[model samples]
Target: MRSPKQDSAAFTQAPEAVFEAALGVLQNAGNMTLLAAHNGGRRLIARERPKMSNAKFLDIRVEGDAGAAQLHVTVGTDPRTPKAMLDGKANAKVLKNYVASVRGAVDESSPAPASPVADHCLQKKTEVPWADAGQDPEIELDGNIRAAYGL
Candidate 1:
């Protein structure tokens, strides 16, 4: 049985910024959608754009606060995807790009904004259109993502 990929990173950037960078990558992916954002926007889940490729999803969790963050990402194959589907190194490539983008590899990081500005930016980014979810069938799990964690 094929399994999804998993990767994680610790960041000095604010949790909000790291999460936003991740959000940026997925938004521009053109083949993914925001599936869920919960725990005060500290966690997110997104699935591949429908009919685009093998049914896959990204589950991201940010642990920490303003001073630092640890990001955990899980790229999973949907139950609907076939077991015989050989993904080659596609998962590796995706993991690399996603981490780079979230870690600001592709974009320069300016000093964080001032308190008021930062608050505004945080509010804006966390208020995604699809999240509470984009278009995945598991849309109902939007905010309750950490049920296993017993949050």
Candidate 2:
């Protein structure tokens, strides 16, 4: 019978499975887009099953209307690459703050514009109208994130 460590080693050797799991995590979270996984990581898309190792890490970026954010999930060795796991702790603390911002915005009233632009300008900001109140400056995690060097 294979030892537990041996079993783990065999599992880690399966890079395709790791990649799929990582992708599943992101897809479950919410808004996310799958860019590409190729280059030294190239031609990866062509292969039906792209294999990776502990030395290889997958970088995923989520793009929103405002900007983008990156999540680097490791294959093989590092299991803490999932965004929810990596950012969950911080998000847990911060999510309350986010809810508060939304609440405050919903409660506050905006001043009446001198010009209604009603059916005139043809361009009215209905979505995120209250987003300018300094509540949350659009959480653009990917564009603002940088991998820790030497990690």
Candidate 3:
């Protein structure tokens, strides 16, 4: 059997909060279907939508308290058939992008430390969305959950 690809990262937020952010990030990435959500335990199991990919599933687990949290993510591909296996590079890219999105969400939720005027200006300029007038901001996550999560 092939081993699943795995990655972990620590976050300076409550485990529950980080779990919630992760759910949002996964849903936003599109074509992910939640298979199980253990809210009390801060764990979720999901998979790429059938139409999107047939072989990949994701397991996300969180642990820690209000002061700190750790997230463990694993990407597994079905081993019943050799052709269904996912490549290491693809799995690593998925994990990296997911972690970055979750981190960004956490950062956006918390207030940043005070910085110089010029620094703040530059940061805002890069992060701000300059959507066209009268057009809605891009929706990264699809479906009703996007509204429920306020993403």
User: Which residue pairs of candidate 3 clash?
Assistant: 28-141
Candidate 1 per-residue C-alpha lDDT over 2-116 given as tens digits, one digit per residue, 9 for 90 to 100: 3678898998888877776666666666677665555355666776644535656677877787788888987755544565355525555666667877766324552222121
Over 4 Å off, model 2: 1-13, 39-151
Q: What is the C-alpha RMSD of each candidate to the true structure, in Å?
A: 7.9, 20.6, 13.7
> lDDT tens string, model 2, 1-151?
0000100111221333333333343333233222233211211110011132111122322212213222232222122233332233333332333223222322233111111111110012221122222221221122321122111
- On TM-score, the candidate that comes out on top is 1
Better of 2 and 3 by lDDT: 3
Q: What is the lDDT of residue 92 in candidate 2?
A: 32
Please give the TM-score that candidate 2 achieves against the real structure. 0.22
Tens-place lDDT digits, model 3, residues 1-151? 1346798999988887787788777656656655445556566655554443434557788999889999999875534435444455555666677778788877775322311111010111132332232222222222322232222
C-alpha lDDT of candidate 3 relative to the true structure: 0.57
Q: Estimated TM-score per prediction?
A: 0.63, 0.22, 0.63
* Per-residue lDDT of 105 in model 2: 28
Order the numbered candidates by TM-score, best leading. 1, 3, 2
Worst 10 residues of 1 by lDDT: 114-123
TM-score: the better of candidates 1 and 2: 1
